[model samples]
Each structure stands twice: as C-alpha cells, then as structure tokens.
Target: MQRYFVAPAQISGHTAVLEGDDARHLAQVMRARPGDKFIVCDGSGREALAKVVTVDKDIVRAEIVEERFAESEMAWRVTVAQSLPKGDKLETVIQKGTEAGAAVFLPFLSQRTVVQYDERKEAKRVERWRRIAKEAAEQSHRGVVPEVMAVSSWKSLIGRFAEYDLVLLCYEEEGRAGNGLRRVLTEFAAKQAEGGKPRILIVVGPEGGFDEREAEAAAAAGAKPIGLGKRILRTETAALYALACIAYASGELGGD
Candidate 1:
C-alpha cells in the first residue's frame, strides 16, 4: 500500500486532507482517484486506512477508514551522536540509521571534523536531512520519524550525557574485548532493571577518530568508552554498527 505522512490538522473526525506535496503526489504522481485506498501516518505513530473522496489539483481529501497505533518504533530509545562527516555522508547516516530503529540523531563537531557547515545554508541542509529521515521512516514502516537535530559543539555533545540511562562511546584506543558491547549492555540492563526502560546514547567520532583528551572528558561525564573491535570503521559505519548491535542484543531482531 502507498504510504504518506499527514499533518495533525489535515486529519479530523475520520477525514483527512492531504494538500500541497502530498496532493500533487496523489493526483499527478500516483494518479489516485475516489475510492482508492492507502495508508497515512500522522508522524507521531498514529495511522489510518484512508479512502480517497476527492482528488483536486492542490488538495486530496480522503476519509479515514480505520485508525490504530503503529508498532514499528523501537522497544528502547537509542540516540546516535555522530560526528559531522564530509560530503553527503550525513544523509546516508540519517537514512540508514532511521531504518535501524534509532530514536534520534545528533550531529556534532569534533577535533578531526574538517567540513564546516555554512550558517547561511544550515536551514536548507537541516531541511534536506529531515526530508530524508521522513522518507526512510515511511519506507521502513516506522511509526515515528526520528528527529534530526541541529549540529552541536563538542562541549554541548558531552554535556548531554546525563540525559541517558546508559552512554557508550566508541574509542579506538581501547584494546579489542571479546563480546564487549553485548556484555556491557547486558550488565547495564540488569543493574537498571528496577528503573524504567533504558535510554541509550551511542556516540561515534569523525573520520580522524576522537582525540585522547575528548575521550577522557566524555568518560568523566558518565560515558563509558568501549571498543568496536580491533578493525577500524569509518565515521559513518561506526554509528550503524553500534545501532545494529544494540537491536540484535535487545531482541528487536525477533530472536528469543
């Protein structure tokens, strides 16, 4: 079924009005008509089966047939604090990271970061990244569209460590420990079992990796520096790897 996101105001009392871009896509792109059925999500995990009532040039009206809660969000919230990579790499991160069940994305600057974000174009860049996240979320059948936050400074990144129940920082300086992630995560969960669900923060550095001083500062601020194995990964790959490992260990992969 074709799926699109609808604004909260666009839907009311079993009726949904998809206008502007969605309207154009339905009329000109999908060529939908009255009685045609598709799925629409409100971007906050609410979804409905809607049937087209009218398809005008700039507005597409559909009556919602059914409404239910979406089940595609992760069992545990995982935030990825990724260092800004050069070129269009951040787009790839948001796209794939959303598919992997990340709850939020934070782009941060590190000592090794070389590409500078031009303030004049920051709005446009952030808009593009959010759009990529929306499309990826829809395609992945996700209930929620992961938020893409503005770029942060190194201090700001570390300062937010207290927000999560567990914080893991990928450090190349550490020796390879067998099954380190799984063991640490398991232990953390057991210790915090009395509390509510875990809110995890996984931080990955830029291409040149984290400076020793930065890693030390992060450790001091409640983040545990862990190794992603002996082999080195690119800045982009590190975030994906950590997210995948977390999902598998948490049984989000459907294993018993």
Candidate 2:
C-alpha cells in the first residue's frame, strides 16, 4: 500500500486528513477516490490503515481502518553528521540514508569543507533536505521520517557528542591503519547489550576529508575513530556505507 506521512494533528479519533502535496498526489497522481485504501503515518511513528472517504484538490480525508506496526525501523538510532559536500550530494545522502534507516542527518562545516556557507539560503536548503528525507521515508515504508538538521560548524557538531551513546568518526587514516567499523560496532553492541536502544552518530568529512586537527578534536570529544575499510570513500558515500553496515549489524538487514 502507498504510504503518506502527516502531522499528528491531522489525525483525530478515527479520521486522517492529508493536505498539501500529499492531497494533490492522491487526487491527481494516484487518481484515488472514496474507498481507496492506503497507509498513513503521523510522522511520530504512529501509523494506521486508512480508507479514503473524500478527496479534493487541496485535501483528502480518510477513515482509519486498523492501527498497524511496520517494524521497519532499525534497532539502533543512527545519525549521520555529514560535512557539507559540493553540489546536491547532501540530497543523495539524505534520500538514501533515510532508506537505510538513518534516524537523523546533521550537515556540518569542517575545516576542509569547500562549499561556502550562505546564511541567506540556509533555511531553504535545510527545508529541501527535510523534504527529501520525508519522501524517502514514505517510499521506504519507514515508521518515522528522518530529521535533517540545519548545518552546523565543526565546533558545534563536536559539542553535541554527549547526545549520542556512540560516535564513530569516519577517518581514512583509521582505514589505512586497518581498524574497521565492524570491530568497533561489535564492541559497542556487546557493551550496550543490556541497555535500551543505543543512539549512534557517524561523522563523515567533506571532499578534502578531515584534517588531522579536526579528527583529533572529534576523537577528544568521545568520538571513536573507525574505518569503513582499506578503500577510501567519497564524502557522500561514507555516511550511507556506515549506515548500511550498522543496520546489517543490528539485525535491521535480516542478519543473525
């Protein structure tokens, strides 16, 4: 069934109201009418099977049929702190990362980051990234949409280290040294086995990658330096790669 996410307020009692783009998509693109059924999520992890009762150009109202759980989310909450890469690479990361079960995306500015920060366009850019995340979440049948946070400075990013249970710094130097992500994640899994769901932050640098000082600063902030493998990955590829491995390790990918 097609899935759509709406604000919690949009769902009341046994009714769901889908407005804006979703409404148009259903009314025009899907050619949905009364009795058409679909899944609707409240963006807060709550979802229900709904049957459309009415449809208009600006809105679509549906009656909730049954509340259901997809269990499509990962066991671990993974946040990707990605340095702003050039062009629309961040869009790719947000889209694919959401599908891979990333819980959040943090675009930060590293020392080697070449893209100039434009304060005037920051809000718009962040909004676009969030839209990408939402669409990807819906298409991937995710329980909740991944958050795309506003861009932050390197210092600001490091300061939030305490917010996560584990912070993995994707450093090529560590990759060359042969220390791998699997080993680090395995140790972390064992350590947190008895605890509740753990939150993980994977920090990936920009095109030029993190300089020695930036890597050292991240490590000092309790972020463990881990390698993706011997092979180097681009800035955009690192976060997605890390998310996939984490998902597979946590059994979200059907591993034993």
Candidate 3:
C-alpha cells in the first residue's frame, strides 16, 4: 500500500487532508482520484487506512475507513550521534539510519572531523537530511519519520548523555578500556529481561577518527567504548552496522 505522512492536525473527525507537496504527488504523480485507497501516517506511530473522497488543486480529502497501530518500531529506541562525515556520506547516514530504527540523528563536529558547518550551512544541511530521512522512512514502511537535528559540537552532544539509559561509543580503543560492545549489550540485556524500555545512544566518529582526549571525555561522560571488529570501518558504515546489530540483538529483527 502507498503511504504518506501528514501532521496530526490534518487528521480530524473522519477526514485526512493532504496538502502541499503531498497533494501534488497524489493528484499528478500518483494519479490518484476519489475512491482510491491509501495509508496515511501521522508520524506519531499510527496508521490510518483511508480512501480519497475528494481531490482539488491543493488539497485531497481522504475518509478514514479504519485506524490501527502501525508496524512494530523497535524494542529499543536508538539515537545515532555521528560526527559529520564528508560530502554525500551524511545523506547515506540519514537514509540508512532511519531504516535501521533510529529515532533521531545528531550530526556533530568532532576534533578530527573534516566537515564544518556554520549556522547558514547548518540550516541547509538539516533540511536536506530531514528530507532524506522522510523519504527513507516511507520507502521502508516506517510508522514514524525519524528527525534530523541541526549540526552540533561534540561537547554539546556529550552534555546530553544523561538523557539516555545507555551510551555506546564505537571506538578502536575498547581493548584498553576493559569493556566492549558485546559486554555492554550483555549487561543491558540482563537488565531489560526484568522490565522497562531500553534507550541506547550510539556515538560514531568521523573519517579521521576520534582524538584520544575526546574519546576519554566521552568515556568520562559514561559512554562505554565498543570495538566494531579488527577491520576498521568507514565513518558512514559504522553507524549503520551498529544499528543493524542493535536491532537484531534486541529481538526486533527475528532470529533462529
């Protein structure tokens, strides 16, 4: 089924109104008309089964036939805080991260990061990443569209560590720290077996990798360093790999 997202305000009573670019897509691109059925997601984890009742130049009215809980999101809410990578790599991160069940994306500048964003460029970057996330969510049949926040600095991201239950830092230095991702996940799983939701914050570094002092600072902030493997993965590849593993390990993805 075709899926579209709209604000909750657009869905009132039995009608779901499609406005702006969505309206144009339905009217022209999709060639939709009255009586055609489509699924409208309000980005709040709800899916409404609707059929078009009326179509106009700027708005399409859809009648809600049924409403149900959307597809399963994830047992754990993972937020990926990545140090900005070069060029189109950030776009790839946004798209794949959304598909991997990331609730939100934080693009930050680290000491070794090659990419820099000023206020003006930051606004444009956020806009671009948000669009990428939206389209990816739709393509993957995600119930909610993940958000892409404005660019931030590593120090600012570290300060927000208290908001999450567990913070995992992907680093090659985990061998020296006496802690690894497997151990961290094992402990977290033991806790979750009892009760409550798991909220994990994953921090991935840039192409040049994290500086030693920066890694220590993140550790002091309570983020455990975890090794990906012996082979070094690129900045963009690490976050997606981590999120995929997290989903599978958390039982969100079925296993034998």
Q: Quick one: best TM-score, which candidate?
A: 2
* Better model by TM-score: candidate 1 vs candidate 2: 2
Residues 8-113, candidate 1: write the lDDT tens digits.
8777998988888878988898999899998898889999999999999999899999999898877679999998999998899999999999989999899998
Q: What's the true lDDT of residue 171 in model 1?
A: 88
For model 2, how does the per-residue alpha-carbon lDDT over 1-256 read when each residue is reduced to its tens digit?
A: 8999999898899999999999999999999999999999987788999999999889999999999776888899999999999999999999999988999999999999999899999999999999999999999999999998989989999999999999999999999999899998887777766436899999999999899998999998899999999898988899989988887777666746
Off-target runs (Cα >4 Å) in candidate 3 are: 175-180, 193-195
Candidates in order, TM-scores: namely 0.94, 0.97, 0.94
| lDDT per residue as tens, model 3, 86-177 | 98998998898898889989988999988656677777778988989988888889999998888888889999999999998899777355
Clashes of each: 0, 0, 0
Better of 2 and 3 by lDDT: 2
Give the local distance difference test score of model 3.
0.87
Per-model C-alpha lDDT, please? 0.87, 0.91, 0.87
Model 2 reaches what TM-score against the true structure? 0.97
